[model samples]
Target chain A: MIALVQQDGPLRIEITEGVIEPLPFAIPTFQDESGTAGAIADEISRVIAADLSGTGLFREIPSTSFISSVTNFSAPVAYPDWKAVNAQALITGAVTESGGQITVKFRVYDVFSGAELGQGIQIVGTTAGIRRIAHKVADTVYSRITGETGYFDSRVVFVSETGPKNARSKRLAVMDYDGANVTYLTDSQSLVLAPRFSGSGDRLLYTSYETGQPQIYVMDVGTAERRALGTGGGNMAFSPRFTPDGQGLIFSLEQGGNSDIYRMDLQGGGLQQLTNSPAIETAPSFSPDGTQIVFESDRSGSQQLYIMGAGGGEPQRISFGPGRYGTPVWSPRGDLIAFTKQNEGRFHIGVMRTDGSEERLLTASFLDEGPTWAPNGRVIMFTRESQGSDGAAGLYSVDISGRNLRRVPTPDSASDPSWGPLQN
Target chain B: MKKITIAVMLVSALALTACSKNRFNGQDGTAGAGTIQPGSANDPSSPAYFNQTIGDRVLFAVDQSTLSAEAQSVLTQQATWLSNNPAYSAIVEGHADEQGTREYNVALGARRASAVQSFLIERGVAPNRLKTVSYGKERPLAVCSEESCYAQNRRAVTVLTSAAGS
Candidate 1:
């Protein structure tokens, strides 16, 4: 039965399972409304186009292909000109600079229907945060066009590596989702690994080896002040992750020569042992709702994935595959879990349901591990080390559908990336 | 025949010099691995001597930590030396081959070190004299990807330190 599709508005494009043709969109360089706007207008427009094109769902028509240009920000778009060029969607924006602050406003139109999708909104921020303002605008347009949350406005906390493999140095680094505006949080005096951001992205949790042994530490990303998590009690702790609400942390602690998972209340200083087995248990990630946790354990004599209650109880094994699985991260959308699997001399990044069914491998290489999700759950970034003795580690991201695989730019080798939530 | 005799005499003279020089100074052209100093009984450097000559590390099979007969023999020698020199304490650093995940390798390394520690204790070494730490695959003695290098990396090393009165 063919159902008549109703167009909710000009921006609503119905997506179905079939051969999908790329949508053509156009964004003329944004106009400068004030003399002080300088080159920000053009830079912001280019960034927005790049962001949209990176998704692989839309193709940006070069400005040379446009029949007309948007010289004024407030003027209505000439729909006939865009329709003539076969451009289905068009975005127009203006930039103004005043005092030490900059403001940007943009509008999106469905040229085919000749209707405005939404009213133009203005974003104001400090001149230093112009890129952030641009990202915010692009996120707005992306959400409106695709009807999905945008991940471009998020950040990633990862381990920046340098030097040789035997004596490598690692520091915690943060950057924009597109690998821009990088800032190092640690001085590399100690080895850092597996940095995870809080729900609000105000703080970070990672494992550091400052005291001659791996220990968990939490730091305020803005202030750079840090403190050891929980009382060390003469034990080693590592593989840390924040709880869903950011009020607690789940990590692996080695005591008496055995490793197990534990949960700690950050606000109340309460500690609870989640798993009490002689076998190894580590890499615990909370479900989006904070009711369940999916982690890796070796109780069955080989590494495998398992799920248990947040408060801790009997854990039912989720992975029964042929190879070992580790570093399981639940998707923000609460539909799938991403993990690193080692099988037949090769490592791969894979995803599976909460019940461990319909497993799909996204990437395969000599060594690919530590998969983290984008804010929108559409992409995953992981550590891929080359083969042989001279191999180096670097960060790579792939769309969840296994397309658009790209290397994230970094000055040195990088690993253990944890993408943060979208900035408010 | 005269030239051959002279050549053998020159070679014998050079070998004699090398042997006398090594016997007096304990120095050789080759360095690293098995560079030991000849000493008397109950030498003040006995702990270092044991570490350098008797071997302080034992290798393990791929992912298994079960002690091999050769590894057990080394541990037996270590136990005897530790009992003879009670003032020295040992730290067993467990390490794993870079063939598995980081977290699992760490656990596997810890198990290997614990195996060494248990064997030492069972052989009459004081439990308090031994401490265990798992470096996982972080610290590798050999930096290669082949099995020969991996065999060297998957080992537990016993590092001895002087505890003075203890």
Candidate 2:
């Protein structure tokens, strides 16, 4: 927890500098110009503030600390009053409703410079999606101030877990990036794991233990409709991911006793085996550009990561550290691959360059696995299960710079988060 | 007392004769020989017998699929039991301890299950009567984080089904 009005310096924060002091910012409740939208306008303003403050990059200045309040939508700038309260950034907005739709307009201001950082913009949406409208507002402000895309408007598909560790039941679920609007996709009668999002963010691919077999299934997110992906026919298959184009899938298929990587054309129904190995090979992920794939294999007698072309061929080993690596997820930016590493009984969430250099472990825990990259490629979310008879699993996220580690709030014990792209 | 004991032995012999005829189609084989109740742990042909006497599961070491001598011993008995019960098909469920990543544990469990499958095939069990699935670290028999529990969690269980066998 950080104080609302704190300061480090006026210098521009370089993201690569690692953990820095939180910048102080203030967002006054959007003025309800129509008076009819007062409640919703305040709600929208609160959501935007929560979205920005949750990043740990900015701290909120409580309304009680404000020296002056602007009750007008087009009020002249009172930058001196904002700077007097130690505010480095300020956001002011107004909301109005006509019939069923509401319009929200906001401006981002650099209090130190006494100028609006970006031109004021207005967003129009229905009252039913007020929170989404707020998230979009925060995203615009974040992009203008940080010079990076925002992840606030995205949704995460994950495995919602229930019951005890030994007798647990898992259901496929989707929720807002901030853990709101939870809607389950499957019942708890069967076990599910590792739900991945399509590039468009409207479809999902996951593994389910239906038919007394572990098989992959692709689902239409809006309809909750699904069908088994018949890549392996009568064999066991799991750990599926969609290609960048969403026209193909890469997954693991087990035959006889060996598990290997496989690809399937979603539209043409053509299947291709990507790896042929007697040793264990599974958990394959495609590069952002879809030309390369990173996967884990024990072909060298232990679990290590290897890179191969999207089309099958010989794989070049990439992971050379002392620890074992698995669940390698390519960053949305296509530059880094995040993975789960285990060494000497401890687990870590780590990231490495595509060529396996600059290997940095972002988090260490009793159990941390299944890293999912945020749309901006600046943060990674994963599952962290505690160690004990009563230990439980939960979702957590960390900045790519390895700071601001926080548990993502969820309705129940959850794991295996796959973040979708920013909503349109 | 001696006369009654002789009479009882004759009746038991009659019951064993009925069992040798495969009267129950040899599917579950829960019916016992002679005085033992059907499906009881003491029943020689019952799945309970296979579970308790022939061993329904084989344990694996951390991150290893190489069968230990003890595991092979249990699997050998399982093979003989399956061979005798021709009406049963087996689904070998391979599992791993909660110490590894989800998908890697899955691949490791597959290796363990395949090891057992190979051993069973070597022992003359029909390959068609066998199928394998790796649960990875999704399911666990023991919930603790210690080696004692992990040893039990890392196992491959041969679950018998009543489906017709070729």
Model 1 has a DockQ score of 0.12
- Off by more than 4 A, model 2: A1-13, B1-35
Candidate 1 residue-wise lDDT at B73: 93
Candidate 1 deviant stretches above 4 angstroms? A1-20, B1-48, B164-166
Interface RMSD of 1: 20.0
DockQ for every prediction shown: 0.12, 0.22
Q: Write the per-residue lDDT of candidate 2 for residues B1-166, one digit (tens) a residue.
A: 1121121123334543543343222234454456776676567677777877677889988888889999999999889988998877787889999999998888788888889989999999999888888899988999999999999999998877654521
Instruction: Report the lDDT tens digits of candidate 1 across residue range B12-33.
Output: 3454354334221112223344
Model 1, TM vs. native: 0.88
What digit string (tens of lDDT, one per residue) describes model 2 on residues A57-153?
Answer: 8889999999999888798879889989978899999999999899999988888777777799999999888999999999998787677899999
Q: Evaluated with DockQ, which candidate comes out highest?
A: 2
